[model samples]
Target: MAGTVQNREAFLNQIAERLGRPRITKPVERPNWNFRPQDEVLKSATQDELLEVLKEQCKRIHTTIYTTDNSELSSVLNEVVTNYGGGPIVTWKDERFSHWGLDSLMKQEWPNQDIHVYEWDHTKGEENIAKAEQANVGITISEITLAESGTVVLFSDENKGRTVSFLPATYIALIPKSSIVPRMTQAAQKMREIHQNTGHVASCINFITGPSNSADIELNLVVGVHGPVKATYIVINDL
Candidate 1:
C-alpha cells in the first residue's frame, strides 16, 4: 500500500475543470451517519459466540463451514479437497501453511500422488491466473473474517494471487478463530490498523461472501453465476 501511487488530486482536478469550477484540494469534514455497522448486533459477543453468528450467516450465504483444530487441519483439508473431487489444487505462497503443517500435504504428499498442487509465485505473474483457472480448488487463509456478512477478507500480494479466489471452480478459505470479527466495522478498523503500522499491506482488498450468486428477471437466486461455483470456509478452532 505504501509503494502505490494514488492520483487523487489529478483525477479530481480534471473533473472540476470540466465542470467549470475551481478545484477544491483541501479535505472537507463529512457528516457522520445515523447508523453504524458496529451499532448493536452481537458487538460484544465472545469468540465462541461470534463463531455461532458466523455459522448462522454462512447458512444464508450458502457457504459450507467446517471447524477443526490445528492438529486435525491437514486431515480436514484433505477431506474438503476430496469432497470437491480431489483437485488440481492451487494455494497462496503463505508461510502459515508451514506453520499449520500443510506445506508437506500440498508440496509433497498431494503432488506425489498426482493431485497436482500449485502455489502462487510472484515471478509467474499472469501465468498464475491461468493455473488458477484450471484448478478445481483454490485455497487461501483469511486475513480478517467478517462474521456478520459471512465474508472472508483477503489482502492480495505477491504471495497471494487475487484471482485464485475468483477463477477457480471452488474456493477454500482457512479462517483462524483469532481472525474472526463481529462485522465489517471491525474489519475496517483492522485494515486501518494495518495501514498505520505496516507497509506490507496489499493495494487491493477483496470481501468475498460465499459463492457467486446471481438472479434472473424472475429473481431466482442462482449460485455460482460468474465466479467460483462453490465456496467453503474451514474455520480453525485453535490455530
Candidate 2:
C-alpha cells in the first residue's frame, strides 16, 4: 500500500482518450544507436589509466583520491579517516568491509582508539538517522565508480541508508579497482544488466561526485554548503 498507484489507470486512460489511441502498457525495447560517441570514449584504457582519469577529476571536484593494493587498503582507510578528524564513523552494514580485509580495523582497532562506530541497522529506523547526523564521518563501499566524472554510485537497501553518506561532516568511499568503469555509459549499462538479471533494482540510486558545493546569488563560491565538507575515495587495486 505504501507505493500503490491508485489513479494511474484513470490518468493514463485520459491521456489515451486525448490522443485517440490505446495507452502504452508494454515496455518498449531500447533502440540501437548507430554512432554512440560516448561508448567510444576511454573504452580502450586499462585499469591504471582509468585511475588516472579519476585522480584528475578529483582535483576539479575537490576530492582526495588514494590508490593502494589489498594489503595496504586498511592502512589507507585509517589514514583518510584520521585526516578527516576520525570518528564517530557511520557505515553501511556491509560484509564487503570484512571481505576486503578491514574487519579488525573497523570493529576493533578504531574502537580501541576511542573512535566510535555505528553500522546502520534497519530495525533502529530513526535512531540510525540521529547517529548519521552526528557522525563525523560516513563510509561506504562504492557499488560502481565512474572515472570520467569521478562519481561514486550507490544503490540503497535495507542495510544501506542514504543518510550514511549524506548527513555526515565527511564522507569516504572504498572503491575496488574492478568496480571502476570508463564513465556513466558503462555504469548505466551495468544498472540495466542488474535490472534484467535480478528482475528488480534498488529504489534509490545516488551518483555522488564530491563534497557539496554551490555558488550563491552573490556569485560567491561555497563548499560543503549542503552536505559533507570533505570527500575522499580509496581505490583498492587488488580488491
Candidate 3:
C-alpha cells in the first residue's frame, strides 16, 4: 500500500510538472470596423408605442419580462420561477449570486413546487454534468453580449460552468445593459482583456445566438438538437 501510494504521488507530481504554471498573455489591440450601414428605422410616436413594440416582440418570441429596482433581484428571480413553470434552475456557486438572494429563492420556491435549484462549482465535474443534464432551465449572469446580433459570450470559469448553459432545455441569462456592446469585435476585445488579466484562458468560450437551431434537412428548421430550445436574456440596466 505504501509503495502504491508513493507511485500515485509521483505520477501526480510528474503530471503537475508537465502542466507547469499558467502564463498570462498580453492584451491585443482592438479591431477596426468598416461595414456598410443598413437603413432600418423605427418611428415611435409615444412611450405607449415603443412599449407596444417591445410587448409584441416578447409575445411573438414567447418570453417573459420582469423588471426590478436592482435591490429586488430575489423578487425578480422568484417571479421568474413562479411564472415560468417551476423546474430545475441551475446557477453557479458564486457569492454574488448568493448575495443576490438565490439561496433564499431556492429554499422558498423549490420545496413547495416541483422545482429544484442546483449549484455547481465546476470542480465537481461529473456531478455538475449530471445536474445540468437533468435541469430544465439554466440561469447565468453574463460578462457581455451583443444586442444587435443577439450574441452571448461565456468564458469558461468555475462560476460560469459551460455545461449549465449548454446542456439545459432553456437558458436564462442575466446581463447588465452596461455590458452590451455595439459589435462583435468589441466583445472580442473585451474577452482578450479578460484573458490578459487572468493567467489561464477558459477551456471553452461559447458564443450563443438565439437557441439551438438548424435548417439542414430538407430546409426544415429544427431546434434544441444542439442545445437549449429557448434562450432568454434578462437585461438589468441598473446592475
Candidate 4:
C-alpha cells in the first residue's frame, strides 16, 4: 500500500513538473466569456414570464408545480401527504421551516405519522439515512430555482441531508418565489456568494429538474430507479 501511494505521489509530482508549476492554491477568478447572456439563448425576463416558462418546462420534465401563499403552505403539504398516503416522512431541520410554521403544521396534521427531522448529529446520521431511504415522502427547502430548465437547486448541509432529496419515493420542495433565477448561471453566482459567506460550499449541490428517470433499456423509459419517482415544487409567492 505504501509503495502504491508513493508511486501515485511520484506520478502527480511528475505531471506538476511538466506543467512548470504546482497546483493552484489561491482562489482563481474566471475569465470573461466570449458570448453575452442576453445575446446567447437566455435573456432577462419578467417574473411573470419566468414563472410561466418554469411551469411549462417543469410539466415537460414530469414535475408538478403548485403556486401558493404562506397561509396555504400547510394545506399544500397536507394535501401532498393525503395524496401520497401513509408512509414515513423525512424533512430538513431548517429554521425557516419553523418560521413558516411547517413544523407545527406537520405535527398537528400528521400526529400519527412517522416524521423524521434531519439534524447535524453524527451519532444519528446512520439511522437518519436509513429512515430517509425508507421514507415515502421527503420534503426540503430549495435554495434557488432556475426558470430556464425548471430546476430546483439544493445545497446539502447538516440541516438538509442529501438523502432527503434522493432516497425517497416522492420529494417535495418549498421554493420561494424570490429564489427563482433566470438561469443556471445566475444560480451558480448565488451559490458562489453562499460559499464566500460561509467560507465553504455544501458537500453536494443538487440540481433536480424532475423525478429520476432514464430511457436506457431499449429506449423504454423508467422512473425512480436512482431517486425519487415523483417530485413536486411548491412555489410560495408570499415568501
Candidate 5:
C-alpha cells in the first residue's frame, strides 16, 4: 500500500512538473456593455410598491409570501408551517435560528401537525437530501443575497447545504433587506470577501431566481424539473 501511494505521488509530481511551464495565453477583452437600468429599477415609490413587486414575482411563479419582523423570524416560520400545509422545514444548525427560539416556536405552531424541522450537521452524511426531496417546503436564511433579481445565494459551508434550497418542492427564503444588493456583481464580491475571511471556498454557490422552470419539452413550459417548483423570497426590512 505504501509503495503504491509513493508511486501515485511521484506520478502526480511528474505531471505537475511537465505542465508547470506551459505557454500563457493573452486574456480576451470584451466590449463594454454598460446599460443603464430603468428609472424604477431598484427604487420604489413606497414600501407598498416594493411589497407589490415581491407579490408580483411570487404570483408569476405561483408562490406565497408571509412577512414578519426579522427579530421574530421563528414566529414567522411557525406561522408558515401552521398556516400553510404541513411539511418539513430544513435549517442549518446555526446560532441565529436556534437563538431565535426555533424549537419552542415549532412546538407552539405544530402542536397537532406532523411538522418536522431538521437541523443539518455534516457529521451525519447526506440524509438531509432525502428529507428535503420529500418535503413540501424548505426554509432557510441566506448569508447574503440580492433583492433586485430576487436571487438567493446559498454557499456550501457549515450546515447550510445546497440541497436544502434546490431539492424541495417549495423554497422559502428569509432574506434581510439590508443584505440585498442592487446588482449580482456586488453579491459575488460579498461572497469573495466571505471566502477570503473564512479560508474556505464554497463548494456550491446557488443563485436562484424564482423557481425552477423550463420550456423545452414540446415548448409547453414546465416547472419543477431540476429544483423547486415554487419559490418565495420574504424580504424583511426590519432585519
Candidate 6:
C-alpha cells in the first residue's frame, strides 16, 4: 500500500511537471500580430460590380445565379420550375415570403403541384422535415449573400429548418440584392448585431457555397452525395 501510494504521487508529480506550473506571478501578454487588410476592391466596388463579382464567384463554385427585377421574379421562378419539370416544393413559412407574394406566385405557376411550407409548430415538425427531404425543390430566402466566396448565410429558425436546403434534390434561394455583402466578416458582424439588438439568434447558421460535393471514393468528383445536387440563387434587385 505504501509503495502504491508513493508511485501514484510520483506519477501525479510527473504529469504536473510536464504540464508546467499552474500559478504565475507575471502572466505573458499575447497580441495579434497578423492582420488581414480590408479588400480594396470590395470596399470600392459599386453595387453592379459587386453583383457581377458574386455571379462569377458563384459560377466558379457550381452555383447558378440569376438577376431580375422584383416584378419579373415570379416569371423567373416560373421558368425555374418549368426547367425543373415541376415537382413537389418545400418553402419556409416566413412572413417575409408572404410579403414577397411568393405564395401567390407559386400558386399561379404550379397550381396543382404539391407544396409544403415549414411551420413553427412542433406538432408538424417531423412531417415538414420528411416533406423537405423528399421534395423535388426547396426554396428559401437568403439572409445574407457573401460575395467573396459566393456563400449564402442561412439562419435556421422556426421557418428555415436545417434540412430544408440540404435534403432536397434542388435548392433555390431568393437573394435580395440588398443582402449581398462584400465578405463573410460583414455577414458575421451583421449576425452579431442582430443577436445584440434582439437578444436572440437562430439555432443554426448555415453557410452554403454551392451544391453538395465529395471526391472521397476513388477520387471521382461526385455531387449531391450528402445534399442538394443543384443550387440556384435568384437575386432580386428591385425588391
**Which residue pairs in model 3 clash with each other?**
none
How many clashes would you count in candidate 5?
Answer: 0
Per-residue alpha-carbon lDDT of candidate 1 for residues 1-239, written as tens digits (9 for 90 to 100)? 23766997788889999999998767998888998755676778999989999999999998999999988999999998999998899899999999898977888889887899989998978889899989999999898998889999999988898988988899899999999998888888788888889854677899999999999999998877778988899998763
Q: Using alpha carbons, what is the TM-score of model 6?
A: 0.80
- Per-residue C-alpha lDDT of model 3 across residues 1-239, encoded as one tens digit per residue: 22434586667667777889533335778677575343122321333343334344545444554444457766776666565566887876667566555666776657567677888866777889889998888887767765445566776676778888879888887666566555466677677887799855677788777567778869998888998887776666453
| Highest TM-score scorer | 2
In order of appearance, the predictions have TM-scores of 0.88, 0.94, 0.68, 0.84, 0.71, 0.80
In terms of TM-score, which candidate is stronger, 2 or 3?
2
Candidate 5 lowest-lDDT run of ten: 36-45
- Residue 141 lDDT in model 5? 77
Give per-residue CA lDDT, model 5, range 1-239, as digits (tens).
22434586667667777999634345778676677454336654345554555565666656666666657766666666555576776666666655545566655555456677676778778687777777777777766655455566776776787788887777888776566655476677677887799886677777777789888768988888988877766667654
| lDDT, candidates in the order shown | 0.89, 0.93, 0.67, 0.81, 0.67, 0.79
- Prediction-by-prediction clash tally: 0, 0, 0, 0, 0, 0
Model 3: lDDT to the true structure: 0.67
Q: Where is model 6 poorest over a 10-residue stretch in terms of lDDT?
A: 113-122
Per-residue lDDT over 1-239 for candidate 6, one digit per residue giving the tens place of the 0 to 100 score: 22434586667667777889543435688786576575443887777877889999987889888998767788898788667656677777778766666767665546655543343344586888888777888888889988888888898876668887888899888898899889977887899999999998887899988889889768998999989899899998853
RMSD of 3: 9.4
How much is the lDDT of residue 6 in candidate 1? Answer: 94
**Across residues 135-212, which tens digit of lDDT does each residue of candidate 2 receive?**
999998899999999999999999999999889999999898999899999999999999999999989999999998
Residue-wise lDDT of candidate 4 within 149-183, one digit each (tens)?
99999988776788888998898999988888888
Structure candidate 5, residue pairs in collision: none
**TM-score: the better of candidates 1 and 4:** 1
